[model samples]
Target: MKDTGWIAATEFVRHPSMVGSAFPASARMVRRMLAPLDWSNIKTLVEYGPGSGRFTFEMLRRMRPDAQLIAIETSQAFVAKLREQCDDPRLVVVEGSARDVRRHIAAETCGRADCILTGLPFSTLGDAEADIIMHETALALKPTAVLAAYQMRTAIGPLIDRNFAQVRRDFEWCNIPPCHLYWATGPFKAPKTARLHLISSR
Candidate 1:
């Protein structure tokens, strides 16, 4: 496996808005973010912003042999590098935006996802983009499906809370700039007017 630490660092320097973080998650933080999942039951998983595929490979390792993971990423460099480095039959690398998560999930699973995880920087994406991603995520999941996201702050928590009935917040101080990890479940269909109200209020 190729080491992506330097690749990720270069992308972060070139595009802070796109990369979200300066480094891939530490092994300890990755463990905590994933500890909430029932790995045995995750048949279809989706990951947003899988920079250099740090979390992608780990999830693929723990998933069932027949399970699939769809990794959606926006950075061209990361996407190309991931496709080059990963040969896992179960992994589908999509070069796209998380705002269109529903389409990506449908194209692969043809059903609801068992779990979705993200390292997206919602804080920099504005309320509207975050709302859209959250809403689309709900539409793409089965009931009680998990959405695990780590951000630099809790501002994204309210947006996530609006889409899911249950949301738990954890802090991982071992990471660069620290991280606010949210494990959310039981997605609710977002009201048609929710996004407009939230965006306009800000």
Candidate 2:
């Protein structure tokens, strides 16, 4: 999509809770966070809080031509901007809360998602809400579906661990606050590791 960085930054100031970061994630950071996914196997991708299509367009570029992407955003301004800027037949920008992702995913793909990309700030959310999103997200996805996410805080790791069995922790130091990144799968199963912290640097 066109450069929506400035628009994204402005939105963050107006809606910090919803936008999560002041800057649209660095291209490098987004690349590292998404590199683990096997793009060939991803037919249905769901993105939680795709602010201004940074990750949305990238995923679209990498996913199969016939695949679909459903992006759930709470901010109407962000949603409008995405809808206005992107015309790819593979993209679906929904103006709604990430908490209701299951409904959105079901409507778009009519099945469980192959992957879910999280961009929401769990640290800023209520305990109950964060727990619900994680649990429901696990249920909305295939048992072995991937949950690739990036956060400016580490608190979300344990919450994700509760629902996903295999969790791998990593970090990218090139972003706004030098955030934490995670790749989790094997939903609704016992976690093999409490936390595997690779903790890499830029």
Candidate 3:
């Protein structure tokens, strides 16, 4: 079997639109993206395009024991590799497009995700496709949930801004090519039944 790096490189060569980046995210990049998360309170987590499981491993290590992680990957090779490498019951690797996140989440879990992390390169994706994925992601997340993503280019920043009520930007230069991190919340309306006091308390 080929190693993860080799597999990732091959996948990128074959499907540049899908893979996006030339390399998987560095450990430092993954750490920075996850730094603001409250692992103890996260019950359901969703990951889009978890190529080679770099960030997946870090997320699993830090998340609560009883928490569940749903990794949605369109590449069969990457999906198979993740299943083989990770044996944790908390993980469920699904082979599908990020645009259909809502369906996958509904089939795999009962609750809306507490957070959605992505490595999807909107720069490589067509505007329509990226819009659908972003819209679906917004719908899949709980009202207070977050969306975190890292990209080598800032072309996707405007699209993210349109989808979320608030956006925070950060950068990490330790990675090979460096990347910009975007943290976003809301733009999705809260349930009518949701109490203002409870929402304000969190």
Candidate 4:
């Protein structure tokens, strides 16, 4: 893959348009975000909004050859572009929104996802839409699954806190705009739930 060319194309890729360039996450960033996932415990991994196969490629590089990778994307052009770049047997590129993750992976009794990586432009989504995505995310994850998302907006931390347990800020200086990474596990529990209520719903 011509890494330089791919990054350049992200500038004009259409579909769910955003100001930030598609600028795929760097190898270092991918490693850092996925560092918490125990490789030995993972079998099926899902990448939400894998634009241009940046993080997808990194996942391919790290996982075992037999591990299944399901990439859910909304852009047809990006889906096509990603298909062209990804020819690995372990990877499965599905052209659709992250909201459809449950439907796509439901048939596989053995394909329970252990980790979910999201790059959706959450800041642009309305509360309802974001809620649906979060709801689906919770359903798609296993009992101990982890959700790692990148938000360019610092104020989006509360949104993450609402849907996830053990929510914590992970990274913010990796990208050009310095994204804030939100890391959480499964769903919020009792103690955290009460604390969650204490947080101002700004």
Candidate 5:
């Protein structure tokens, strides 16, 4: 089997539409994205666009022993690789789009997810597709559950604000091209109308 980096590059070359980034997320980026999460309360976690299982591995390492992780990937090759490499009974790798997060979670697990993480590039997706994914992700998460997503650009902030009750933005500079990390919580009765507040990481 080809190494993950090679596979990621090849996948990007072959299907840019499915695989958003040319490289897998760096370890630093993954850590920054998962930093504020409260692992004890997370029983069911869903990861969208888990390219090369970088974040998947990190989540499994720190998550509770009985916790379940559902990895939703659009790339068949990456999905196969995750199944082969991760080998954890708690991990469920599904080949699909983020737009069907609610369906995937319901089919794979008992209830809604406690958290959803993504490194998907919303800018590359069409407006309708992005909207569907954003709404579905919000629906899949339990009340007070968090959604953590990291992107190279900041364009998706407004869409996130529309879905979640509160949004907190942070920056991580350790990666090749740093990332904008958004940590959002809630599916409250009325979503917040506040703008994203950017905070610099120490």
Candidate 6:
């Protein structure tokens, strides 16, 4: 198991009532999700619900010096903590809900994003709220943009169908409880029906 420091940090940052864990993706997985991205064409990247800035820090590290990173987090405590933790001028930490993706980006970054890394737990969201957030996400994305979301839930067909042209599951069995990562492209046709392998732990 990874050290408890990371564990504690995540828990401290995530909303107390939130069902999802604050655990950040392993560095390897993070790199893989971002590898296909053409960094040269990417001037801005937005991260939704960046708990403790795990992926936020990583994105900052990998982006070109001219590139900027915007992390939209709703928790006030997490936002204050992150503000203290990160000092990079290229990084902008916004303490607000990602549901307002377009306004948040337009006000802070002043441009549409080339890549978006989301860590929200859609499984907990109501259908109406989910639809609104998803729609806003599409509006915020550049035509060629990619949105990579990490979900611990195996059943993401609804999300995949509603928002993506294609859905690829990059499974990491080594992680605790394991996880199913999703990569999606904007303006995708919703699938009629889809099946996925659901794993149950003893």
Compared with the true structure, what per-residue lDDT tens digits does model 3 show for residues 1-202?
6789988999999999879876889888988899998888899999999999999999999999899999999889899899999999999999999988889999988979999999898888988888778878888999889999998889778777767789999998988678999999885543222345577889
Model 6 error, position 157 (Å): 3.2
lDDT of 1 by residue, 1-202 (tens): 4458778888889988767888888887888999889999999999999997778989988999999999999888888899999899999999999988888887887888999998988887777787788788888889968989888877787777677888898899998879999988888876436766888999
All candidates' TM-scores? 0.91, 0.89, 0.91, 0.81, 0.91, 0.80
* Model 1 clashing-pair count: 0
Worst ten in a row by lDDT for model 1: 187-196
lDDT digits (tens) for residues 1-202 of candidate 6: 3343454456645543342664556766666767766778778899988776667887887888999888988766667777888799989999887788888888876768888888677766666666677767766887788888777774455766566676666876655446678777764432222222222221
- Model 4 over residues 93-160: C-alpha lDDT tens digits? 88777887888777443545787888777777666677677767776878787888876665456656
Native-referenced Cα lDDT, model 5: 0.85
Candidate 5 lDDT tens digits, 90-115: 99999988898888988987888899
lDDT of each: 0.86, 0.85, 0.87, 0.71, 0.85, 0.71
Model 3 residue runs over 4 Å out of place are 189-202
TM-score of candidate 2 to 2 decimals: 0.89
Worst 10 residues of 4 by lDDT: 11-20
Candidate 6, TM-score vs. the true structure? 0.80
Query: Which parts of model 6 are misplaced by more than 4 Å?
Result: 1-19, 188-202
Q: How well does candidate 1 score on lDDT at residue 155?
A: 74
By the lDDT metric, which is better: model 2 or model 6?
2
Query: By TM-score, how accurate is candidate 4?
Result: 0.81
